[model samples]
Target: MTESVPPRSRPGPRRGLTERAILDAALRLVDAGGAEALSVRSVAAEMGVAPNALYTYFRTKADLVAALGDDLLGRLDLDAALGDADWRSAVVRLAADLRATLLAHPGVVPLLLHAGFAGPRALVAGEVLLELLSRGGLPADDTARASYLLQTYVLGTVALDAAELPPGAARPDDAARTAERRRALGGADPALLPRTAAAADVVAAYNGDAQFRWGLDRLLDGL
Candidate 1:
């Protein structure tokens, strides 16, 4: 979408301008072109409605983004994830579900990066996490701390994955990653840094389900 995008004006208040409809329109724009492509005018153009029509549902582009973030969070099936008998299994299931959501809508990841998902839907997810932590035998303080650790682990991993892999890119930043790895390891010489040299290739590879699970399980084990 261009900066000069023009709104598609509709007569009057554009009957049936529900909040859900407006959110749906915004979500499509974000999914197609990421957060930077989202704007009041751009969404209006996508929805075939005047820019002002969205103001009834969202006060600004920021408002729309937040609502969309919460909407996405609300999509997670907390009960299904928590259905796992053990707390560790439940946490893994919940985190996995969240990761899937973030990967599916890579556009919304930036919204979480900056503004954060602090709305009602976000609160619901938080509540579920806290409950799971509490049930895992953590005291009040440990539960709060564990909640932070688990949430940060999930969000940070997803954010890093989005930045490194991106969407619709083959061999994403392969050269850049190799160059960075070389700089960090300084040749990883087998004679001088044999251990580093042995695992250098592993550290430079792309992360996927196995990597994600490995890190998540380690964090849970530490807890």
Candidate 2:
């Protein structure tokens, strides 16, 4: 009698694409098509695999997005880029590099805000920043606070830079929206918003990069 053929087994782990490969594919999808375009199905399609395949690597969309953000952070070399610069210059350059990375991968900026950095290079950046702080004679508490403030400023700035508004939508029509929003807030009841109503125009002025720098400088100066 002819022997029955045994069932074929699935490929082992070494034969399949890695978790890192899956994340890299996901990041590419986000980079090319924006955050709204990234779904596990879409990434799987991009990778020429089954939709359910990515679930084994990234259990959920949020988890995948977080992993992509972490991967992007791994690509940055802030401490190395600074070379032998002084603490202030090194910190400033690091902030600029961080901003550039976010802009280059705008789809991941929101993810970064929600998840922060997690990979090895991110840890290196932090360690070097702290070491520089110690070298610059900062007390531990102040160093910690300064690092927090600097990162917060960078993240907030990049979030705004990556914003997407609907087509044909004016950017809040500054003057009109200021007056409209002010009236909505307290409708000619200046007492409820004395300073705000009196300074309606300045409210719109408070939302751009110039203001971002101005605010960051004020905080840095306070240190």
Local accuracy by lDDT, each model = 0.78, 0.69
Clashing pairs in 2: none
TM-score versus the correct structure, for each prediction:
0.80, 0.67
Candidate 2 local lDDT, 19-130, one digit each (tens):
8888878778777766677888888888888776676678787778777776777666764645755766666666767777767677767666776777566777777777
Q: How many clashes show up per model?
A: 0, 0
Question: Across residues 1-223, which tens digit of lDDT does each residue of candidate 1 receive?
Answer: 6698789885555678888888888777777777687898998898887788888778887888888889888888888756767877888888998988887777778777898888998998888888887788889899889988988888897887777544433233446666676577766778987887778766754356666788898988787
- List of clashing residue pairs for candidate 1: none
Query: lDDT score, residue 173, model 2?
Result: 35
Candidate 2 regions with alpha-carbon error over 4 angstroms: 1-10, 13-21, 164-217
In TM-score terms, candidate 1 sits at 0.80
